[model samples]
Target: MEYRISEPFTKEKFAQLKAGDTVLLTGTVYTARDAAHKRMVEMLQEGGQLPFEIKNSVIYYVGPTPEKPGNPIGSAGPTTSYRMDAYAPVLLDLGETGMIGKGQRSQTVKEAVLRNGAVYFAAIGGAGALMAQRVESAEVIAFEDLGAEAVRKLSVKDFPVTVILDSKGGDLYSEGRAAYLESRE
Candidate 1:
């Protein structure tokens, strides 16, 4: 089923989502990649303030290209998610509620999601240009030295995503495959 979800996700809102559900997300989504993750984790370790509010916020794992004339952002697309696995649990423990990216997360991250009542959404891979259109606005919010890998604050309206992992421990990556194999029998 499809649902419309907003940023700064609440426990009640996320609890309704299950793996395999389609969602149109409308609100702010911060962009961050591997380098940014490393920095954030280091900052957390040092007891430094994060660039943005962590509680219930969504972070999109993307490194968008330079914007063309008349566009809010360039080819904004999800990068591999596993690269952030090392830092995810730490962030989740601090109240991060959502992540948008491509591919499966590590078991550690999946467990963290359940532990923290968070959800992981999979944005369509290889659809950068299409994804960029959904972004209403984008601006560098932190880590400017990282260029495309810089942290960006994006205002997205009706951005499409699918629930890959939900707080209930529902996982589409494994469940989908299981269903497909079962159907062949």
Candidate 2:
């Protein structure tokens, strides 16, 4: 089922979602790819405060292209999730509740999701132009030196995503692949 959800993802909000559910996420999302993630993790290791609040937040794994005139963002497609897997668990443990990315995650990230009552979301690949339309505003909040890979705070409206992994350990990728194999038999 398709669900329309906003930010400040509470326990109740997360509990209602499951793997394979469609989500139209509207609200504040922090943009971070592997570089930003690594920095955040390093900060955490050093007991430094994160640039933004991690608790009850969603992080989109994207490094957007240059914006055209008057647009909040450019082609903002999701990066491969595995690149951030190394740092995800640490952030999740620190209260990050949701993620938006593409491709499979490591077993560690999957375990962290369940352990932290978090959800992993997958945005469509090659749909960057369409995805940028949902972003109402975007600002660089941290890591500006990284250029396109810089961390951004984005205010989005009806940003599309799918629940690839859920708080209860359900995995859409695994289920979908298994179903596909079964159908071929």
Where in model 1 is the C-alpha error above 4 Å? none
Error of 1 at 86 (Å): 0.3
Per-residue alpha-carbon lDDT of model 1 for 58-93, expressed as tens digits? 999999989989989999989999999999899999
User: Residue by residue across 20-128, what tens digits does model 2's lDDT show?
Assistant: 9999988999999989999998998898999999889899999999898988889998999999999999989988999999999999999999998999999999999
Worst 10 residues of 2 by lDDT: 7-16
Per-prediction TM-score? 0.97, 0.96
CA lDDT, every model vs. true structure: 0.93, 0.92
Score residue 122 of candidate 2 by CA lDDT: 97
User: Highest TM-score, which number?
Assistant: 1
List the pairs of residues colliding in candidate 2. Answer: none
Name every residue pair that clashes in candidate 1.
none
